[model samples]
Target: MHVLFLAPEVWPFKRVGGLAEVAYDLPRALAALGHKVGVVTPKPRLSQEMEQGLERLDTVLEVPVSWKRHLAEVYRHQEPSGVEVYLIGHEHLFDREGLYGNAYGDYEDNAERFIFYSRACLELARTMDWRVDVFHANDWTTGLVPVYLRTLYAGDPCLKDAASLMTVHNLGNQGQFWHYDMPLTGLGWEYFVPEALEFYGQINFLKGGLVFADMISTVSHTYAQEILTPELGRGMEGVLMARRDRLAAVVNGIDYQVWNPADDYRLAANYDRHDPSPKARCRQELMGHYGLEDGGGRPLVAVVGRLEDRKGLDLITAGMERFFEVGLNLVVMGYGEDHYHVALGELAARHPGRLGLTIGFDIDLAHRIMAGVDMLLVPSRYEPCGIHQMQALRYGVVPVVRDTGGLADTVVDQRPGVEGTGFKFEPFTMEAMLQTLDRAKQAYDRPQEWRGLMQRAMAQDFSWQAVAPRYEEIYRKALELAGQRQRA
Candidate 1:
């Protein structure tokens, strides 16, 4: 199959979230599975590794921006597993130091920027005569791909037979903008309907993809079902329900080659599924590095990813004094709201021994934090499907995740013989999380019981080798749908 992935970011090049990581790793695995997979993403400000990695491919294609056209270069990189990556290189649109923006706010012209990129990718693919079998677009940034292919590019020779699959990593960011902006970016006003792009009287880029794409998928099966609800649904329930048969819930996978604790380059000491003692050594190293005590007594709970309200970072902040009261230490690596940043800063200052907070992601430190921490926290309000819990589990860091979305699907609560993988709570409330943590705290006191579950979690597999076939089936299903449409 000839697969073309469209996204705003890709790992090792531009990573602001899990979508980039998926974009980077999944194509490699898909290529290994005998598919011709390639990705088209905005060229991030290049690093030495990035510059060395990508070979210049097709160059200087003009893509329409609001009203005028801008030039972009396409560079290709073949991954170790032989997946070709096409980077859309244009400085004016993507030359910024940050992926999205700095601390103040995202670029005001984000809607126009991503929409232009989406159209550019399709236009480039058409010009290259790449009749994509599956144009799998990730998140809202590239949501316009399916809409453009199905509508404006409907009968174009290169895109006439192409099918699309849009995976909702998280529904919260629906990319809502002023409905009037549609015309400015060349999107038809017909797309701004309640059933299509419009959500709560605004243009919703994410819903446009969900409506027009041949098929839709969320990160996990649980998330797939969860999105069809009123509470969890971000006003897309009706649209999601309309496409019930077209929706799938395949859990996200981790790049074990990079994340494996046993062979991790970031860890202080390598450890396996059997012996987890190195976890303690790694923990001490992490504590020492963060200027915390190296004492091996307090249970270290580390949380990575965005420290936003949606990620349940609020529960952590609300329950900070309680975490220390429960005799636990905290470490965080993420960036978000000013209030969150200031609050976390204060927590780190007030409670030196119990907390360590870094404002943004540190790749090496993230791996070390995963390997070192006794438990990893992902109390997400709504995680479509998280890859961190899987990575933390593989690293022998028992996850204490809120019972929502993929967390509910992946991390099994501690049982008797089943001694499950990690811990789970309900309601997405601090009280609920604290109650579960209390139980986890009790379990932690029983080192033998805790170790059994942590090992069990590490033993579980969340590999792409297991998930790529699911995506393959979905891709085929999209082709089937396209065939039906053609026959009609």
Candidate 2:
């Protein structure tokens, strides 16, 4: 099979979140299975380091955006895993200080920027010598791909047999804009009705993709079902319900090459479940680095993600004082929301030796935290598929997470047998979280039991090799759907 992946960001080149990581790993995994995979993403302001060696194609694509046309330079590079990467360069639109926007906010012309990129992707496919079997798009940024394929380019021979799959990483961020911006899409007004792009009197890019794509998938099976309801759907329940048969829920996978503790370059001491003496050394080093007492006689719990309301950081803030009373030390690393920054700063100051805080991302530190911490906390309001917990499990760090979405699917609450890997809580409240922490502490007190749980976690596999077949099955299903639609 020949597959083309369209995403706004790809790992090691331009990454802001998990989508980039998936965009990088999934295609490589497929390519390893003998599928010819290609990735297309915007070329951000590249440093000399990011563009070391790449074949630049002389072909300049003239992409139309509404009434105007923009030129883009295409460059090709091959990954070590044999996947080809195509970068679209439009300095005026993509070569920015950040991927989407800077610290202030998202770029005001985001709708237009992505619309242009989507059209370019289609044009690139239309002109390429090889035929594409699947055009897999990710998130709201590439939402217009399916729309263009089914609408304006419906009759184009090149794309008539190609299928599209749109994977929604987060339904919360539906690309919604004023109805006036519909012209920017270079698509007809007929697409702006409620059944298509329109969402509560506005133009919704994600809705357009979901409506037109041969198939739709969320990051996790639990999240796929969650989004079909009003509370979690973010106002797309009706449209999604209409395409229920076309929806899929494949859990995301992690690249073991980068995350494996036995050979990780980032960890202070590399160790796996078989040899965990290095993990204790890492814990001691981390405690000293944070200025906390190395021998506190308490479990060290860590939080590593954006400190936003959606992450349920507020729940931690609400229960911090009580958590300390239960004899546990805390370490946090992330940056988000001015209020959270200020609140976390004050809390860290008050607790001094008991709490440690790092305001920004440190990749090395994140790996060390996963290797060192006794427990990892992720009390998200709703998580599509969290990579942190998966990485934590890989490092033998027990995760105490809210039982929702992927967390619910992956983490098995501590049970009597050897099957248990982590702890979970319900209702998503401070009280429930604190009680869950108490349970973790109880298990922690029993060193024999905790070690068994850690062993179980490290033994569990969340690698892409385990998940690539599921995606392959979905791709075949999508092709069948597209063939039917084409015949109709």
| Minimal lDDT window, size 10, model 2 | 288-297
Question: Model 2 scores what on Cα lDDT?
Answer: 0.89
Mind giving the per-residue lDDT tens digits that candidate 2 earns over 313-396?
A: 999998999989988999999987888999999999998888899998888898888888999999999999988999999999
In angstroms, the error of model 2 at 64 is 0.6
Q: Which candidate tops lDDT? A: 2
lDDT of each: 0.86, 0.89
Give one digit per residue, the lDDT tens place, for model 1 in 354-424: 79889988898889899888888889888888888999999888889988889999999985666689988
Candidate of highest TM-score:
2
Count of backbone collisions within predicted model 1: 0
Q: Once model 1 is optimally superposed onto the true structure by TM-score, how far is the C-alpha of residue 335 displaced, in angstroms?
A: 1.4
TM-score to native of every candidate shown: 0.96, 0.97
